[model samples]
Target: MSRSGGEKERKYESDESRIDSGIDSYKSISRDPYWSLQSSEEKDKSSCGTEERLDSAYASSSLTVDSLGDFIEKCSISEGENATDSENNNEEEVNLLTTVTEDGDTILHLAIIHEEQHFAHQLIELFPRELLDIQNNLYQTPLHLATYLNQHSIVKDLVANGVSLELQDQDGNTPLHVACERGFWDCANEMIHNASPNKLAHVLEAQNWRGLTCLHVATVHKQRRLMRLLMKKGVNLNTQEGTSGKTALHMAVELHDVYMVNLLLNSGTDVDAAMFNGCTALHLAVGRQDAAVANRLCQAGADKMIRNMEDETALDLADGNDDILALFPFDDIQIMGRTVINF
Candidate 1:
């Protein structure tokens, strides 16, 4: 009977060991990271059966299991908080770059206007190409500001990185127009030589609000070298100004610039291109009593027969100057009731 009792006791001990082994396996699965991924309600539902078993099997271990659950919950909350903070940080960074001031100037605009070259460089690299063309309150883009400020390096960088060359500021002036107007050849050259053939063509033809192309600007500013640079790029020699319908050649003659006159003539300018008042360069020359200019126009194949709005030809405007009248090949000239001989 004693030996039978011993066998039963050993069997009971083995069964208890099996119970502990199963509980350890359950605890291991509960500690899995996969469980941490579940929602709080799902985790509670999943753990309910295990929790009831733990409480029934060992009341003392219930506290331990509850503490472990709490630890995981805290960890999950901490991770979520970190994730939210990370998102906020990323948004703030983007806003820092994109935010505009009351003047509608972006950080990049201010950087350039303030002559902060180093900061501008950093911003340029950080900004997307389209953002490089953003205009401020006055409708001036970064490129416009750069050109206006004569920032040659910035202009080069902006153009090389694919900023839109056609964007106009408040005055309808493109960056190229500003460069030309200011005689900033370094800035102008960067834009002109770096542009695609089609784009350069379009820009050369683009006019400002004053109805002046870059060529006209160069001429008005007496930027001879700049004018030559433009002409070399295939600018339209006979493009008329919007205000007066006068070409660059007309302005050159009006400015009494013999060098410009010769330059335009050699560049195939329309010698007899008329102005708004139906006046040709020769008409203005003869009216100004500039015999030398009249002679030059005559030599360049100027049509002296072209009449002005005043119903007068270039010959008619040469009132009494034999030197002016002599430039035309008229054998008989009647001027101020004087019969003159043409040379």
Candidate 2:
């Protein structure tokens, strides 16, 4: 052979040797003695799944070919192993063993996201522990995820499995708060009134990173029924968020949610509670040019003379608001000219 050919053969030999070494190294480490039990456990699933797949493969292949005898033999061996695992109750126990992802999600998390009720049931039957305590990277628990996704059955399963009813997320907000924030009225009601401790007072008034309470979220989502439910649960209508120092009524005004505003007012929320901005709900109504809100506030004995940071009164806020004046009767608007024009 030529010298170049000899060199090429040598190099090829070296590369093949390195490749074989790498393969061996990978198998050795992956099946390391230190992880013998785990490796053994891992093989059971992979081998079983492969056997199942092969069984299906043969069944499909039989449609095109005459002989599935060999495939059937292989599948029979696998079926025997599956029977053994089943008889030993390993299958039930294995499925229930909680598996946490790198993101801290339990098997329940995967079930909820994938809508795998069968798989979820397997998990539940195995562990039967609430395991709802597992939090995702977002710092929300399984209940929070289920509530946000509106997974009714999963919520029931989790509650029955013993997940703490008052479990709070990193933000100190509970699952009920998340449900309310996401407009999952049924989930919220179920969590609060049924499965949970009905500590609605704590949850309804809980704040998120923005210091917005459950009522604030409900108003934004126009979840009036949830609002009524929360109110019936005795959520303090006047609860003020620390960040904005805004009451639920102020939040309603900010959202321009007429229904929520009416609900809040009817619930006896202090319509006059001033926020950190020193603006009352009345000022918000006047600023939004919602004369109906303005009229409602004034009729409800809301003092328009309330001052904000700028020391401007609600009447002074009416100067450029033609839309707001449009809400009042023409005669009322004209007569309100007697209203003080502080601006």
Candidate 3:
């Protein structure tokens, strides 16, 4: 009887252990990530039309997915991806998304972030055609990012494919804008040399979200050499900023760069270019108490009577302070313009 009881107890224990083991296995199969992936694959293969199987895709009727699936669902499909279906008119979209994040970064963006040339090349190879296209997010194409990151080879590769240097972002910024703004001359040259010189020039004058052109950015950053390239690109020698009415010359005068002053003047930039407030470069110089710039502007034929919106002249900004006038001593110089007489 003892032997029988012991045997029965052992059997009961084994049965309980087997049941628990089976339950644990079922739990893993149900909850494991890999199992979920397999189930997804199986489901995908079974459904000839994936339109109905979109899990959480159209949970909200207003939210739309603009991707490969959208292309496939169209009824008027042409002749491209599949021959078996009567409607296969979908064009073979170049797979640009080597790695697209939920937030919309591509592999090219990652290449810039990592500074990985080899990785960039690999990603570029994944879809050579798409390399020329701008991304939906950040308003920067691969070419723009390459310019920003100073990747000359990457820029060369993309520009060779005819990436539109003229393509503007939501801000109206172009590839040249990115380069000139960041002071990346090498990258800017790569784009220009690869195309008709006229193509990027118009883009150079293209403004950004802030209504600032590439020339404006270069001036603000004090990038004198970039100013040279911009002039070569035919950026308006006299393009005035809309809000401030400050031209490249206006900012250059403020920076105390006499060379830039001469360059702008030689390039036909108006020394008397006025800002929104009607303050000319001379006015800006006076405001900064920079006599050198003031004298240079006067020599460059700056009209002394240009007034601000408030009717305050350059001298007025200086408060008719003799110390400020002493910097330029414009009254002493005999030029085409009369000395500003502050009453």
Candidate 4:
């Protein structure tokens, strides 16, 4: 009888352990539906229709326009509540904004993406200004998207609504950086002009993750008009990027973009500005065998005698390249002496 009782007790303990394990597994699957899938076949079917699932989920009346309007109204009403109520209301408001699609795009993001300008405008007016800077899965705010998509009106609305101009995306590119990179002068102008005097300097000077200033971006893209506008705004013309230590003028010369080089030079850019490697614009021009650019640089008073870190002068870099060598007028001193005498 003792042996039989002991065996029965062991059996009961084993059965209870199995029951507990089953319950824990059920709870895990319940919390995450993805874990409930039995095979790769089920996972593929679920993953393939994610967008469609999101669309249907959004269409299920829980995330409709009416719901958004209701949410806005509720938040507005909660603003006048007592401290305790206000705290709870703020939490609720956060939850409303946190509601997102599978891609982590808020309703505002969708409105901007779909060009629902009227709806976007309504949402902008009703939503808290803080929501304007909320980033999507791409870490792009509505303002960033507007600037990138060239949505002028949306950009204006965002600015007018007091969105943070300094908000950076995943790559640390502020909206203004994107504007400068893409040569969106209109958008850039809007942002600059709309900014408070106190903020204007900060906005213009904000660098991207690559340590490129707005002026650096303009130079890299050969944006003559944008460059002029930025210069007019009194941006530091000689600001060198940390990576290459090359000023905009150096970049202009390197690209062999004579037009940009002329613009920079005429604007009083340091003609002989050198990179971190001590390579001057004249050195780069000679290396490219660009006679016209070389001549322009010489006329603008670029020091051809300047040596790079490699200990090579522009003429030395020219080596046997006659086109570049010929641009350096050997009679420069004679011409200067004659002019002075004539004067």
Q: Between 1 and 3, whose TM-score is larger?
A: 1
Candidate number with the higher TM-score (2 or 3):
2
In angstroms, how far off is 222's CA in candidate 4?
2.4
- RMSD from true fold, candidate 4: 13.5
Task: Give the candidate order by descending TM-score.
Answer: 1, 4, 2, 3
TM-score of each prediction? 0.71, 0.65, 0.63, 0.69
lDDT of 4 by residue, 1-343 (tens): 0124654454344434231121123223333544333342343334342322212211111233444557556554422468877677777767765677644567776566545576677778777888878876557788887787688788998999999888787677888888888889888888878888767778777777787888888889888888998888778878888787888888887888989988888888888788899998888888888888899999988886777888777887776787787866564442311322321
**Model 2 regions lying over 4 Å from their true place:** 1-96, 125-130, 170-173, 195-198, 320-343
lDDT of candidates 1 onward, in order: 0.75, 0.61, 0.62, 0.70
The alpha-carbon deviation from the true structure for residue 286 of candidate 2, after best TM-score superposition, in angstroms, is: 1.2
lDDT of 3 by residue, 216-325 (tens): 88888877888887777677877776676678887787788888888888888867767877788888888888777777777778876677787766766675567666
* Stretches > 4 Å off in candidate 1: 1-89, 333-343
For model 2, how does the per-residue alpha-carbon lDDT over 184-223 read when each residue is reduced to its tens digit?
Answer: 8778767666644455455666677778677777776777
Pairs that clash in candidate 3: 77-89, 78-88, 78-89, 79-88, 79-89, 244-275, 244-276, 245-275
Index of the highest-TM-score prediction: 1
Off by over 4 Å in 3: 1-99, 122-131, 169-172, 323-343
For this target, which candidate reaches the highest lDDT against the unseen true structure? 1
Error of 3 at 304 (Å): 1.2
- The ten-residue window of minimal lDDT in model 3 covers 55-64
- Clashing residue pairs in all predictions, respectively, total 0, 0, 8, 0
